[model samples]
Target chain A: MSMTLEELTDRTGLTVLDHLEQQVRIPVVDGLQAQGDLIVIPLAVLDDVDVPARARWRPVPPSGVELLRGAAGGNPHTLVAEPGAAEWTTEVHDRQRLAVGVLRATRPAYLIHSEHGGSGIAPGTYLVRRQRERSTQRGGQADFLVAD
Target chain B: MRPTSTAGTGRRRSATSGCGPPCTPNPPTGNAERAITGLYALLGRRRPRFHWAASPRQAVDLLDEPPLRLGGPVDPAAPWHVAHQLADAAHRLAGRLDERAGPVGTFWWTTERIVRTRPPADALAAGVSLAELLVVGVRNSLGRSVHDGLRTPLRAALTEAVGEPPGLRWHGQHDAPWVAYHDVRRRLRPGLFHPDDDRQVDLWADIARSCGWWWPREDVCVVTERTGVAHTEALPGALHGEVRTHNRHGPAVGYADGWGGHSWHGTAVPAWVIEEPTVERIGAERNVEVRRCAIERLGWDAYLDQARLTLVAEAADPGNPGCRLQLYDLPQHVWGTPARVLLAVNGSVERDGHRRRYGLSVPADLDDPVAAAGWSYGLSGEQYARLLRRT
Candidate 1:
């Protein structure tokens, strides 16, 4: 009953990962700092990340997960969070020929979206690993698979 | 209305205090000024750094990492519009790349098509339908007028910048053109897959572009430079890792050596099996500080180094486990320091199960084999990117 989130995800089933897909919410600062931003935090000063509140997705080939980098030369931007009708939420689509994992990061103080897809698992979402507090060298609790 | 100063002008200043100095209203602050003032008040102290950092485009691009066009703060909604917006943005951006490239049509849109779905009772895997895979690839390369969507923007931008339509390279394949080399990207990537009948993947048969050539692949092998388990604890020695698989699919473990090439124990899923954590493990042991300092900087080059004096030094102690390390002198990885690494994972995932995991010890940098066997590892930028995480 008390297995760390990492343990839960380590035993990740398609069901569980899929379930978290619907849980994607607006990314909290920590999620961005520690994860989303963490991945590409330094690609540059990150001049801009003008994602819209809503987005449409398609799978890219030869690789998984790319920010709609842009058509040949036009500036590329990704649509991200949206203020939902009832609450805040986000979504991801499998544009690829096959399904793959999507990573998400969130905090406990905030609310993430609830699962609504037909499948019990929200396939694309973040799974917590080792959550650390920014202010101190302490451990915090984490939930698995927060979708981006 | 005047303040009810009836008896309230307790100080009884003078005639100068008449009507509170004519109700002199200070000029109203503009919306931009008021907004700024309110922000400062809410924040309490003036954050000098934030002021400078918040200049025009600074923050906008900060959030501009992936999932294009709708580049705002990331969200959790599964909206149809979000996908459309990003695709549109991608089309726009692709156009710009061509504009910047100049007259040669140096740019092109590549796509792939594969069978991703299988009937439940068909006895095949969940995503093995090649036909489905092909459909999805076309959808990506041509769907939503993907090519048109992207090409128009590319052309306008190109014509503006240089003056020509970009040379095009469609990565996907449909019923047309039947046979020619495809884009190098079509070479086995694992992440992009879908069911044969998924609605999103169906447009390929109706609208698709054909290509004349496939990307070239190499059957190169990266032999490990060091040997045995202790090589792991030796810090620097551990970084010298490598492995050789069929230039494209999975790992090369459990293979029988043969000039004709060998077979491997694998997931057989037919995709790129990027073991990013394993790449980090090498970084953890060899350059823990760097890994901690900034992860992005730890490219493959960092792992490739001369067999450090230690391994050569280990030769003196044939009895030392470190000395009996595996040999990775592929003529391909003999660049700069002449360091060597081989990707070696347990040949079998389960002692009894046939599935295997390969631990490829790639140089943190690109070190080409120095031999004349025309040996090139042919590692793609994407593969190198696979090993890295945002630092």
Candidate 2:
């Protein structure tokens, strides 16, 4: 029943990046959204894991992975719910806030904003954190820090 | 590995190691040919009774005897096996020794390294004198008992597989309780074996050698105190560091931390804590004092807290501007080697006064913080074990 990342993507009808996302269980935050390539998974979902123990932050790219946004000025970047995926209920305080996560795989998940051209954000489904509220500057992209 | 007779027993038994025909010197057609043939024959058989000779000439003479066939030398690392056999024999001898001859703790400590680690090959090649080490080992075991003619040939054959006796020195009763010394500055400081105190002096050597001198160097400590004594009536101030409690059997149970008013059984006594910078020469007296003060003041959990924090601080990426990275929690217990961590990066803060548009990326294969901290503290695996023993 074991398959490589490519095979899992082919079998499950998920993108290569989505296949990586399927490797780790991510938490669901009510009212939380994915801005740019950013996604929020509650820390509680990691109850069975010890991510904080080693204190590592992994980054993945924000390109190509499918995500559904909230309609009509709601959370601009929210993930479309996956069928049969296990979900946990948790609260998110601010529209834009700091959050943490671990990457499920390394692949191009989203396009990098023009401003971050000098900084290397590899293509992958990253464990990400919402570092802060997205800047409201003109043409500024809602950016999330992703680390693997 | 049978119970062998004393070395003094007038009996000889040899393991059938299939050595070829007895060495008969060929008649000399020429001095050089005869010498070469003799050397080849000597080199061909594996003879076992060789002892550590005091002089080169004596070693050569010993090798010249028929029973002393210098068959191909055993593996260099075989000295450990040799020392194991020797220790087994010494253990038997310990039962015959007088109580005054001192407990077997001193003997076991003395032989710990020799029996546990491989001796250098050159030293093994030079040959070990089991006969000599046996006399010394047996003498120490006897304590005040006269050497009851135990150096039997059967005893020597016990070391047939192992070539040489590892270098060990026994100080015996003259040094009293601390009767053995190993690895130069180290002392086999023996106190009475107390079941309640849980101090197994024989095993102490393993911990000591395992960690070197990193653990606390106290002769005894109050590992646990009996409940219900008035706080004021607890371990008296006068009996602090050197206090030793003996059970009904008259064996010392544990030592007391006079300052903290707690007693520790042997098992509870922690290893030396390296608090000071100067580790080169930790005086024995100062070592115990420092250990007592530390345990009484900081405690084990506090030390772990500090150690973890130190790891986090040291792992920070100083080069990244406002590059706030920290370890959030410990890795799973099963995780080993270079660890992957849940890193928290503060993207809010500006480094070098730059407001960046994009968030930071996490690096791969981060440096191991705990290892770095241990090195910074100059703690070895054994010293680190002290901290783990508590947690």
Candidate 3:
């Protein structure tokens, strides 16, 4: 069943800004979804990424796993799921060096942010990647990760 | 709460509460003077003549001779500098304390690693005790906040405006982290350190709680009052009340002598960046981070129009219906680099019911807006084109 922003926050004890729509049901997407600077793509969509055989996985806790915090350090994009419903691993090899982690869910898991609200993930394995921009300070071809 | 968690909670509470230097302008109390005298007594020296200053800026000016002369040959006959003697004593004391604290084990290392990285809640949930959290909080978190966060930046600014300090200085308030760390250890693990060492730690802790900065010499000591005005904001993800200097309208940290610095989200920047950011000023600024901060202060839309950058290309953003991706050339003089700016709209609506637009710097060679956008996500232009949804 899909959950609203209020329901998700209440379940996880996480909070969002009061301005966000609280009652609307958050969509559970089986495909790709973007939240701020983070993008979640179904594992089947990418050919250059791989999850190794010896990868360690930790079950997503009730309080959720904080995936990324904003540049200034306040807002965080947290991944939440029913206990035992999802497992996450950081041992993924991505050609682009942008993969934050890989998430495998047996049931619907949600990515929640104070500003972006919640984006529900359908039961599936997915690769989460952070965005980057060209770095002008270093004078060469270096990329700076976007924290927001 | 778990019954066993109370001890941890108490330790965590005390550590956070005792974490930072007092920012208010409180003159050093008689207790501070007693502590300094006690420290001198430990070194077999009499109490030095105390010279007080309103601020660190004024304190530097009061020095008749450089407290520390760099790159000089050691003279065996010359009396040891009081500062050096104190440093040596502190090192030896710490060594003895370490012996009592026991060897660093895997558990300690694991907890330290987790404390340094993950959120405090996560570390606690992972079975890290509150006492351990207190240790890391005082050593790492408080150190980062008081020493690295505030003192270092303020020191750099002071050095630029004045020069290298006249002598080796002691951060009176900024020394809270180290002192607090030892104090917490002694309190939590009673009798972990010798009584004499505990007394020494108390002296240092008193000074940290009492003043701003200090300089110690054989016959004289120079002490500065606390900052008259200091502004700070909670570090975004800090688990132990860590804070950094941040003020949009005025100096993030200022003293009574009108000496202070401006910071934008912890980054020390020139006053103009905060006060009068203009396109011309931003173009002339060589530092990339400073320039970016100025541009952000000026807003992207206003900067684009005022800078009048040449439009390179434009395309509709996939999945973000009605939003367009526009590219503009950043002049060599403007950015000091061969790069293009891709202006994209946020996928989510903001609280004000408006979508925010931001610019991403891309390699100059990419002329196609779609390819540039794809490059940001490490995907091919064709691959990103199949995107289905944006929040």
Q: Which regions in candidate 1 have their CA more than 4 angstroms from the true location? A: A1-3, A10-45, A53-148, B1-258, B261-303, B307-391
For each candidate, the DockQ is: 0.01, 0.01, 0.41
For each candidate in the order shown, give its overall lDDT on alpha carbons.
Answer: 0.22, 0.25, 0.77
Q: Candidate 1, TM-score vs. the true structure?
A: 0.19
lDDT for each residue of candidate 1 in B142-221, tens digit (9 for 90 to 100): 32122222122222322333333212112222122211111211334322223321212222221122111011111110
DockQ of 1: 0.01
| Candidate 1 chain B worst ten-residue window by lDDT | B224-233
Candidate 3, B162-204: lDDT as tens digits: 7776655687777877677777778888988888888888888
Model 3's C-alpha root-mean-square deviation from the true structure amounts to: 7.7
TM-score-best of 2 and 3: 3
Model 3 native-contact share: 0.65
Which candidate leads in TM-score?
3
What is the full ranking by lDDT, best candidate first?
3, 2, 1
Q: Candidate 2's error at A105, in angstroms? A: 24
Name the lDDT value of residue B257 in candidate 1. Answer: 12
lDDT tens per residue, model 2, B133-246: 322333333221111111111112213323442222111111222212221112222333233212222332222221100100011100111111111111111111111211
